[model samples]
Target: MNFADISSDIRHNQIIELLLQNNNLSAAKIAAILNISSRSVEKHLAKLKQDKIIIRQGSKKYGT
Candidate 1:
């Protein structure tokens, strides 16, 4: 299932850019910035994970 079928490759690439911007921000963070739902962020992340495009780093608490 290529993202090109449902979403734009450039948009996904932008998501990748965000992930790489700072060790992969949380899905919540991305959604907040993009004005989307966390579930949507998760969806994008899942696709990225499946493609081995981004990775998960250590987690940090919110507002800590």
Candidate 2:
């Protein structure tokens, strides 16, 4: 894979690991933890959701 693809995969895995540790994290919180932008975190979250890797439990502001 290209470097960018590998990097994205690594970040995706990290995001999953973080979620496993604390499922209540917000996109902003994940962005801060990953040293990435909130927009990027949101994109990652979208991909995870699309792939059925994760699921939202409630409202965006207070979901787990």
Candidate 3:
């Protein structure tokens, strides 16, 4: 499959994988690990939340 066809899924998968490895990672950290922008990470995260694929459990400052 071409990258253009699966790029969004790839990003979502990367985020899920990173969260699985360490659920406490911040969006910025995920972005750093994935070498993407934080905004992009946030977008994926929002989508995941809408799909009920992931959940946030704590405060933004010091929660996971």
Best by lDDT: 2
Ranking by TM-score: 2, 3, 1
Q: After superposition, how far is residue 59 of candidate 3 from its true place, in Å?
A: 2.3
Better of 1 and 3 by lDDT: 3
User: Which lDDT tens digits does candidate 1 get at residues 2-54?
Assistant: 86765656657767877668654777788888788899777887787788886
Residues 1-64 of candidate 3: C-alpha lDDT, one tens digit per residue: 8886499888899899999999989989999998999999999999999999998887878877
lDDT of each: 0.72, 0.93, 0.90
lDDT of 2 by residue, 1-64 (tens): 8999898889999999999999988899999999999999999989989999989998767789
Worst 10 residues of 3 by lDDT: 55-64
Q: How good is model 2 by TM-score?
A: 0.90
Error of 3 at 12 (Å): 0.4
Pick by lDDT: 1 or 2, better one: 2
Q: On a 0 to 100 scale, what is the lDDT of residue 49 in model 2?
A: 92
